[model samples]
Target: MEETISLKENYEIVKKRIWLILSITIIAALISALVSLFVLTPIYQSSTQILVNNSESEISGFDINDIRTNTELISTYSVIIKSPAILDIVIEELELNRSSGVLSSQINVKPENNSQVVSIIVQDANPTLAAEIANTIARVFKTEIVALMNVDNVSVLAEATVSEKPSPIKPNPTLNIAIAIVVGLMSGVGLSFLLEYLDNTVKTEQDVEKLLELPVLGSISQIKEQEENAFVSSQQNQPVGSVTIES
Candidate 1:
């Protein structure tokens, strides 16, 4: 037979196990909050922009051809900015005790599509260092690109700056807690239904009828030990009336 449960039964199941569900959800959220606040390392981000222009006159010597040429150069500039040649000088200037590969991993170079602007982004545990690294990479790339590519087109457009109260980009506690709450709620509801389905012990007439597929004739009412003993004591104390009846 295909078994089906009504909404009321589901509600009852959830109501019966609501405490368990709540406990699990609360524990998961707390764990996530703790991990986000204390266990995970926070990362700070800083970015600087560099412009590629071949012409000295920004207003008059510009044309569609120049724009197209500069746009094409941005792609090459993105790669050259992250190259060891540029990153090595940046590391030396910053006195960073890391290899070129490690420094490259911390730096990201991206060029705006159909534009002459390239952005260099850096992430680190320290906000000041992140800004410094981004600005240093831009400065080093602009100085070296003239010698490496033989084109004095790269110019620092925007420098990265550190604010008085810089915020970390990663380890967002609110977002982490929100995700944990959703996951915890789902897991709790799932576990509640699973436990209800696995429990096979019958405790009521309805359960008996459902399991046996038969109508119950009657049921014996359960009496507590103290109540049964009191009833027996009352019967024994009523002895005078019985003796008069026998005589």
Candidate 2:
């Protein structure tokens, strides 16, 4: 036989586990808050901008095709800026003990879309270090571009400054808490159903009827202590001759 459950029945099942859901949600929210606020370390980001321009001011004997060629090569500059060649110099200049690959990971270089500008972003635990890395990377890229490409058009548009307050770049607490709450609620509801499935005891007349296919005739109410005491007192006050047994 196919077993079907109604919406009301499903609701009743969930209602039975309300306390479990609430407890899990609360615990998950607390854990997420603690991990986000205390356990995780905050990272700060700093960025610098460099402007790419055509150094040929006079345009003397400079073909428009040459200008197009240079414009198309902007992407090449972006890649070179992030290369080990430029990053190695920046690392050496800063006397950073980190390897070139690690330093490269800390730097992000990208050029504006069809525009003559590149943005370099650096992330580090210390705001000052982040700013220093950004500035040094930009400066080193500028010098290297002039020497390698013979283009003095690269100029530092903006230098990253040390932030007065450290801004966290990851592990957003609000978002994390929200996710945790959702996960906790789902887990709690699932666990509640799992427990309900494991429990085999029948506590209600409805369960008895369902299992034994028996109809309930009547229910006997349990006598309270006060009612029992009153009956005993009435019997004790009655005379011995007044008590008679009916056949």
Candidate 3:
């Protein structure tokens, strides 16, 4: 038969298995920490910003409509930044041991909203190489776009550089541990509830009364074996009803 439980009983069940729940949470956190610190590869990222022409002053001999056109052309320029027209030259200039496709995969281009500024970002296992790629891609894209479009509109706004201490941008350890802790706690509580639901043994007089629908005439109290033996010996040695019994 099935029965409903109150919040107090649920709380008691969890309290009884609190250690198991805590152990699961700790194990999950430790595994996440280990993977974030040692197992996963560290990827370093660098970014460089460039500017697209918004005025004829930035590029000689252009009218107001041309300025708007150039601003709209920013999206096309973003695509060309990763194309072989730019990346092939970049690979040859830096003597990098990667194909144009592979090098392009590590780079990202982003343009400012309703503005002429563009940002180039690159990621690599080596920190110095990441910065070098970011800077070189911007230079090559700027020079190549001039030749391709017959306009001098691109300019470097900020260059990517390596600091004294560089940090990877992926596999955030603390965040990972926090998520694992929440998941582990939820799993443990669910398992505790499931186990409690599966248990059907009668453990109390109330359970018997409810299941059988009858009054309990009496109950046999439990006694330890040593105490029972001692009580029996004492009873055997004592007189019953104030009359000595012969053995």
Candidate closest to the true structure, highest TM-score:
1
lDDT of 3 by residue, 1-247 (tens): 1234676677888998898889889999999999999998999999999988753445567477866887789888988998999999999999999899999889888877867788899999899999998999888887888789877778899999999999998878989999999999998888888887888899878679988999888888899999999888888888766654659
Cα lDDT of all candidates, in order? 0.87, 0.83, 0.87
- Of the candidates numbered 2 and 3, which has the greater lDDT value? 3
- Maximum-lDDT candidate: 1
Stretches of model 1 off by over 4 angstroms after superposition: 1-5, 55-60, 221-247
Greater TM-score among 1 and 2 belongs to 1
Q: 88-182 in candidate 2: lDDT tens per residue? A: 88888889999888987887877677666778988887889899999988888778887897777778999998756777787799999999999
Q: What is the lDDT of residue 199 in candidate 2?
A: 79
Better of 1 and 3 by lDDT: 1
Instruction: Give the lDDT of residue 46 in candidate 2.
Output: 90
Query: Where does candidate 1 have its weakest 10-residue lDDT segment?
Result: 238-247
Q: For candidate 1, list the clashing residue pairs, or say none.
A: none
Residue pairs with backbone overlap in model 3: none
Task: Superpose all Cα atoms of candidate 1 onto the true structure and report the RMSD in Å to 1 decimal.
Answer: 4.6
In Å, residue 166's CA in model 1 sits off its true spot by: 0.8
Name model 3 segments beyond 4 Å from true: 1-5, 54-67, 205-247
lDDT of each residue in 221-242, candidate 1, tens digit only: 9999999998878779886667
